[model samples]
Target chain A: MRPRPPAMRTKRRYILARILPYGVQVDQKQMYFAVIEAATSLFGDAAVGLAQPAVVFCEGGYVVVRCRRGAENDIAVALATVTSVADERIALRTVATSGTIHALRRRMKPSRRHSGDEEVKIGETYFAVYRYPRQKVDLVEKGIKHQKSLFFTEADLEER
Target chain B: MKITDAGIRPYPAGDSTVARMALEAAGLGFDSAVAIGDAVHRPPGIEILRGAVIGAASVKEVLKRVRDPAVRRADIVYVDAGDTSFNRAVVSIKEVNVVRSIHAARRNAFDHVAARTAAEQGVAVDISMAPIIHLRGTKRQRALQRYADVLSLQRRYGFPLTISSGARSILGQRSVREIRGLCALFGMTGTEVTEALASVGWIAEPHRPVEVVK
Candidate 1:
C-alpha cells in the first residue's frame, strides 16, 4: 500500500518537556504510555483518540511529544499532569512547542551533572549526591533498584 | 503584581530544602513562595514568607491556635476548611488569612454565606494544584468541582483567591505557565489565575484608608 499524499497527512505539533528529578531514565514506550494515560484521563478517550498523542523522542532527560496541530495546548496541559513514568515518581516540565522537532530540539538545554560524586549518610541509609548548576544538589540512594532521591542544596548539606 | 506560589513545604517535612525550592521557584516564574514552616535558610532574589496552617475542630480552637508564637510570627495564617458552620465562622475571625483544603470539605461547606463573610473579612480561599496534578479519578474530579464552586463564589462575592502549588518537593512545583493551563481545566480564566497568584500580597498588606498624622 502507498502512503497518503502530503496534503492529506495530518499536520502535527511537537511539545518539548524535561523529565524532572534530573536523572531518571524513562523508556520511550513508557513515556508514550504516561502521556496517553494522562491525556485520556484528563480529556477522555474521545478527545485523546482524536488528538493521537505520541512520544516521538525521549532522551537526555527530555521528551518530545507529537500530537495533532490543534491539540497541542490540551496535550501540553495533559503533560503537566504526568507525575510519573514507569512507576517512578517524576515530573514533565514543558519547555517549548513547535511545528517541527528541530525547533523544539533547539529549546532543549539538557542538564549536565556537575563533577561531584560525593556520598552523604543520613541515619542508616547512604545517598550519592549529584550536583548541578545553580547550587542544586540531588541525592540518590545507593541501590540497584527503586532508589529514593532527596533534593537538597549546598547549604542544606553543609548544615547537616 | 507579585506572582507567588501560595504554599510549599520544605526541609524536614519534605525532601527538598527551602533554599533549593526557592531557587527552583525563581526559575519557574515565581516571585515568592509561602514556606509553611520554620525555614531558617533564606535565599536572595525571591521572597519566602513564613506560613502557619491551623487545623482545628472548632472556632475556639482556631482562635487559640492563632495566638501561638509561630502563628503570630507567620506572614500568613491558613485554616483547614471544615463544615459549613465552621467555615462561616472561621472566615470572620480576624487572625485567619486563608481557608485551605476546601476540596476535602463537603460540597455545602463553603457556600454563599461563607463567601460573603470571607469577602468582607479579606480572607482568601486557596486552590491547591496538588490534587489536580497528583490525584486521579474521583478524587481529582471532586477537587476540580470544589475549585469551580469556589471560583464561582469568589466571582460573585468579590473575595480574593490564592493558588498554591501545595508542593512537598521540587518536582511537585510547577511553572506559572503550567499553572495557567491547569487552572483552565477548572474554568478559571487567565486574568483570574493572575489575580489569584497575586492575592497573597493583597492579604498580607491590604490597602488602608489614609489618615491625618497631626
Candidate 2:
C-alpha cells in the first residue's frame, strides 16, 4: 500500500433547510446556484468566497449545505434570502444546524404530511380543500390557473 | 424569548388579510405582530397590536399628530424618518416608539444628532426590510450601506433598533430568524440581532418591564 494520506483538516459545518412551496421539487444545482447568488448579493463577492458554500445534499425538499465551520450563519442567511429558484417563488427555511450530519438529522423532526379534506374560504367564496405534506393545500376553484394551491403553516391559523 | 414583527401592513391593499398575516406570524414562531392600520378584528393564538404609520412633512405636524388620542393610544407610533427635521423631532420625543424608513430616502436621513437623541429618549429606530428586498443594483447597495451606518451608530450610541418586514404581502414578510440573518449582513452579531428583535416589545409597551435576550 502507498503511504497513508493524512486526513483532511478543513473543519466544516452542515445546515439543514426545508425548501418551501413545499412539494415543488428543484434540482440540486439550481438550489446551489440560488444560494450562491443570494450570498454574493448579500455579502459581496469577497466575503462569500471566503465562506465557500456548497450544497452537499438535496432530497425530499430538504437541503444540506456545507461551509466553513464558522460560516454556518452566513450560509444560513444566504439560503434564507433565496426567494426564487428557476423563476419560481420559493422559500428556504433553516431548520437545524450541526457540525455533523448525524447530529443535524437527530435534531430535525420528521416533516408532517397534511391529509384529508377541509373547506377553506378564499376571498368571499368557499372551496373544498385537500392537504398534503410541507404545508401544501390544494383548493378546487373554477376559472383559475392549472392548479390552485396554498402553502400555509400552522402559524397562519393561530389565535391571539 | 418572544419574537415580534412590529411593522406589518395588512388588508385590501396588502397581499394578506389581517387574520392570515397574524396566523402566518404565529406559525413562524413570532409571539406577536403589530399591524400598521386601523384597529381591526383580532386573530386567535397570537397577539396582534394595532399600530399607525404617521407621515408628516414637518416637525410641528408630527408633534401635533402624536398628541392625538388615537395616535397616542396606538400600540406603536412609527413616524416617517425621511425628512431631516421630522426625524430630529421624532427622536426627541419619548412617546414616538419608532422612526420608520430612515434609509429609504435619497440621502442618509439620520445623522449623529438624531441617533444620539434617539438613544437618550429611548426611541426605537425602525429599519424596514421592504426597501432592501425591493430595490436592486446601486440603489440596493446604497440602502444596505445606510443601514450599516445606522447599525454602527446604534452600537456606539446605545439606541434601540427594531427591524420590521415592512411587508405589503404575506410573501414579503420574513420570519424572525430570517430577519436576524439579514441584520447579520449589516454587521450585527447574533446577540445584537436578538436585542433588536426584543426591542419591539419594549417599544410597544414602554411601561412594562422588558427582558433583554442575551
Instruction: Give the top-scoring candidate (TM-score).
Output: 1
- In terms of lDDT, the poorest run of 10 residues in model 1 chain A is A109-118
Judge candidate 1 against the unseen true structure and give its global Cα lDDT, from 0 to 1.
0.93
Give per-residue CA lDDT, model 1, range A59-157, as digits (tens): 999999999999999999999999988889999999998999988878888688975477999888999989988888999999988888889988888
Which of the CAPRI classes, incorrect, acceptable, medium or high, describes model 1?
Answer: high
How do the residues A33-101 of candidate 2 rate in per-residue lDDT, one tens digit apiece? 988988888778998898899998888778899999888888887776777778766778888888888
- Candidate 1 residues B90-190, lDDT tens each? 99999999999999999979999999999999999999999999989999999999999999998899999999999999989999999999999999999
Pairs of colliding residues, candidate 1: none
Q: In candidate 1 chain B, where is summed lDDT lowest over 10 consecutive residues?
A: B36-45
**Residue A146 CA displacement from its true place in model 1, Å:** 1.9
Q: Give the whole-model CA lDDT for all candidates, comma-separated.
A: 0.93, 0.75
TM-score of chain B of 2: 0.91
